[model samples]
Target chain A: MCLKPQHYEDILRDQPDIGWFEVHAENYLGAGGAPLHYLETIRERYPLSIHGVGLSIGSADGLDTNHLERVAKLVERFEPESFSEHLAWSTHDNHFYSDLLPVPYNQHTEDLVCNHIDQVQTRLRRPMLLENPANYLELNDTVTSESNFINNVVQRTGCGLLLDVNNVYVSARNCHYNALDYMKSLPLQSVGEIHLAGHAVDDSIPDEALLIDAHDRAVSTAVWKLYDQLIQLTGARPTLIEWDTNIPAWQVLLNEMVKADLLLNQPPARLAHATEN
Target chain B: MPQKTDFHSRFAQALQDPQINTRPLLKPTGTANQRRRFDVYRNNRAVSLIDNLRSAYPAIFRLVGEDFFNAAARNYIDRHPPTGPVMAEYGGEFGDYMAAMPNTDSVPYLADIASLEWQRLQSYHSANSPVLNINELAKIDSAELVNLRLQRHPAFSAIQSRWPIGSIWTICTSDAESATSPAEVDMQRSESVVVTRPGLEVLTNVIPATGYLFLNALVQGKTIGDAAEPALTEDPTFDTGSHLAGLVALGVFSDINFTTE
Candidate 1:
């Protein structure tokens, strides 16, 4: 479950039966306030996973040392079970765009992303899980497939994957690729956690559909099917129900969590097993 | 092949500038299709930042109404994109930005209202500290008490505005059912506010001119006696003793330190 400020009182009062909670690292970066105060209180009970939305890990300008230091301090204070960032960039020169922009997946970008990941890992003294971005359009400079790009990053940097299934579904539909094939091509063995969220469709172009990773509603039926299929392959990972926008009531989010929890507990239809002669 | 930075520079420029065609950046496609694809990012960048500003300055948003606030926000967005990832610290210049916009003179108090809201936000997020109690001053010697310097709480801030900012802010932020009408506001009156969040909830107190002067002097590292001089000069009947006690109750001062020499 993702912790939102609106749900703070509910969580504190009910002490709901949740596995753990995830929080956007940037929200708690302030000096002191009700946010930090409640986070500390909640963390005392539930395990925390810090997911950063603004790290801009793929920025070509290298990492922002000042922002990196602040994130490092936050991680130390919380000591979350895992820390994750996106494979997209949100900054150029010195201006932060506040939206995850895609990076061309070629040799130059591969090297740049790997170097930035290495710096982040070294500073934090921990391995970070890199998430696959939800792409709306492909850049002209692309020379490799998205899976290959992610595989190469994992191979070179040894960072785990935060496999967002909704992104896979959204990007696959938008970029004209098979979601199953794309998911299978990646380094599934490195997946440390999973993310499931909602998306909105933009059907403006004639005879075309583009799905935006809006995260503003309930997980779509197709996304749920994909999640179930993924659990069969990956064999039950820590899953999060991400409802960032148009956040519903506490009961609504908890219901979504319960749905994922039910799927997580079910036996995988076909386990990954190697045959021996 | 364009280098990583080159691609980023061009892409970033296009996101901000509407006239620049993204066809040059995207994979070759129909002109309309290229624009439709690129509009997603452009819209996300603008809407997300605007939402951040709206959350930070709800009073400003309500004062100007949605259409006007969004226009001002869009103009401000182009000129002042956030320099970092911390959204809470992103709109530090929006008040000044709104003040500089041309047609904002229609609501001259908009900028000062923004400052009051910004101060409240700063008070809510600033570091927490142990507040100084009035009883703490009893330990000090009477002769040395006047020479004592008081440290302002990390979450304490004072704003002096020409418009009745405090009243306007209260009406804008309060529930609509009980909110005072805008016509009831006295535009000629000068208002000041002292924001403090000694606990979880932030409190905004309407203050007088002498209070602002005394607090400003303390903020500049002036001793109690020196700070009182200005307040006394402003109003002959200024009572430092009771005024200091009131501020202490409000948790304005965090600590009292005396010059070691």
Candidate 2:
């Protein structure tokens, strides 16, 4: 379950049955106040993972050293079990757009992303997980498949992957690729965590509907199916239910976590079949 | 073929200006329109930033209504997107932006209200510290109290406005369902407010001329005795003892440093 400030009091009061909680690292980067106080207190009880939204790991100009330092200090303070960042860039020319922008899959981008990831890992002194981005439009210069690019990044930087299942489904739909085949091609063995979230479908264009990784509502049935298939391939991993925007009540999020939990406990028939074969 | 660096610059340009098309830079899928596909990035960039401003300035949103706020916010986001990643620290200068915008002149108090809201948010996320209680002030001899140099808490901020922003802020920040309308405000009056988060919740108090003068002096590192002199001159009836006690009880000061000459 992703820890939200709205549910801090409830979690502290009940200490709900869950494995661990993930927080957007940027939200807790401030010097002090209720966010830090509550996070520190809650962190004492449950395991934590620091997820960063602004790392810009794929920027051509390289990483923001100042932001990286702040994030490094936060990682030291909280000592989360894992730290993760996106494969997309959100900042360039000293201006942060606050949206994860896509990067082309080519040799230049592959080198730039790997170098940035290496810098982040060296600074933090811990290998971080790089999650694949949900692309709305493919860049014209792409010379490689998205999966191949991710594979190169993992192999070069020696970092794990935070496989966001919904991103796979959304990118697959938008870019007209097979989600299962894309997932199968990646270095699934290096996947450290799994992300399941909801997306909004934009259908203004005639034939195809573009799926926006909105994270605003409940996880769709299609996304849940993709998650199940991935789990079958990767076995049980530290899965998170991310509902960042239009956050609902505590029970609503709790129900989503419970659903994911039920699936995690079940044995994968595919794994059984593979062993039987 | 555009270089990787060229792609980023052009994509960033497109994200900022909708007029610029990403055309050959983006490959259009079979049925998907490239412009519409690229608009998702544009829309996401603008909407996400606009939503951030809306959350940061809810009172402004309420005063101008969503349509006006969204349009104004779009302009603001285009002009000044955040330089860093911390969303909480993004809108420090939005109040100044609103003040300079020609369309917002009708609501004269809009800028001050935005400042107050920004101050409240900063105080909410500011560093925590142990507040100095009134009992601490009582232990000092009356003579030494005159020489007391108090350091304010990290969460403390003082805002002075020519319009009745204190009253307007109170009305706008109330439960939306039961909020008082902006028509209730007396547009001619000036107001000052002290915002502090001594505990978990932030408190905003409207201060009189005397109180404002006294707090302003202290903010400039003046001694309590020096601070009170101007307040007394501002209003002859200024009761220093009572006002001091009130500020102390509010936990406005975090520590009493050594007296300065």
Candidate 3:
């Protein structure tokens, strides 16, 4: 579950049986505040994962050393079990975009992403997972596919992949691709974590159904099916139910976690056939 | 192969300005409606930044109402895109931005109110440090008290404004039914406020002008004698002992450096 300040007390009071807690790294970058105070308290009880949404890893110019150092310090302070960022870039020429942006798949971009990931890993002195972005536009055509690009980055940087299943479903629907085929093409062995979130359909484009990754509601039935398929294939990596916008009641969010845990604890033999094809 | 930098530069330009046509940058495989799909990023970028502003300045949002604040926030965001990822640090310039916006002459105190909110946020996030105990000063030699340079706590800040901003902020944030309207506020009355986070909670206290001068001077590295001189000059009856005690109780001073001649 994504930790919010309002839910901190409830989390401590109930102590839900979650696998781990994930926090946006940018939120805790303050020098000192209640955010850090509460996070420290929560970290003592629950295993924490630092998920970065603003690293702009895909920027061609490269990683922001300042942000990278801030995140590195946070990692040093918390020593979270895992750290992850996105394949998307949110910054350009010193300006930060508040949204995760799509990057073109090509040899040049692939090399750029690999070099950036290498820097992050080197700076943090540990492996980090790169999440596939929710793409809004397919920018360029070249030698590398999205899956191949991610696989190449993992191969070159010795980093892991954070498979955000909602992103896959959103991208597949928005960009006109088969969600199952896209998931199948990913290097599941490299997936260290998985994310399940809600998305909304953008009514602006009436002709074509464009699913925006809004993260507002419960996980959709179709995305849950895709997640189930992925977990069955990958043998249940650590999963997170992310609800950033329109956050539900704590019990409701816990219900989603219960659902994820149920699928995660499924019998191995029953899901073994998923890897056959 | 197109240079990655070239493609990213164009993409960034398009993300900021919807007028920029980036259809040439895309692959031919996707549907012909790539432009409409691409506009999604632009919309998300604006909406998310506006949301950040709204979160940071809820009092301003409540004061101006949602539609006006959103319109102003969108304009400010386009002009001043955030340079970093931290949303808390995103809208520091928004108060000044709002002040310069059109049709805001009617609510001139809006900027000062926004400034007060900004200070509250800064105090909430500033570094936490141990405050100097009252007994610490007792240990210092009486003769050395004049030259003692007391450092303000990291999370402490004093704001002085011509309009009654502190009361305006209180009215806007508290129970609205009994609150006085901003228009009824005395435009000529000046207000000063001290913001500090002694513990986990951030407290904003309205103070006299004398207190503001003393605290402002002390924050600027003035010695005890030098800092107290202004408040004394402003009011002959100013009781430095009581004021010092009150400020200490508020956990304003974090350290006292005794300089020996």
* Interface C-alpha RMSD, model 3: 1.3
Selected candidate, larger DockQ, 2 vs 3: 2
Candidate 2, CAPRI quality class derived from DockQ: medium
Q: List each candidate's DockQ score.
A: 0.78, 0.77, 0.74
Model 1 per-residue lDDT tens digits across residues A1-277: 9999999999999999898899999999989989999999999999999999888988988889999999999999999999999999998889999999999989999999999999989998999999999988889989898899999999999999999999999999887889988998989889999999999988877678878999999999999999987877788799999999899999999999989988887744443331010
Top TM-score model:
2
Tens-place lDDT per residue, model 2, B20-139, is 867868765455477888888888888888888988998888888899888888878878888888899998888788778887778888888999999999999998998888888899
Highest DockQ: give the candidate number: 1
Model 2 iRMS (Å) reads: 1.2
Off by over 4 Å in 2: A268-277, B1-5, B28-30, B176-181, B259-261
Each prediction's RMSD to truth: 2.5, 2.1, 2.6
* Model 1 regions lying over 4 Å from their true place: A268-277, B1-5, B29-32, B138-144
CAPRI tier for the interface of model 1: medium
lDDT of 3: 0.86
Provide interface RMSD per model, one decimal.
0.9, 1.2, 1.3
Runs in model 3 with CA error above 4 Å? A204-207, A272-277, B1-5, B29-32, B135-147, B175-184
DockQ of 3: 0.74
Candidate 2 lDDT at A89 equals: 94
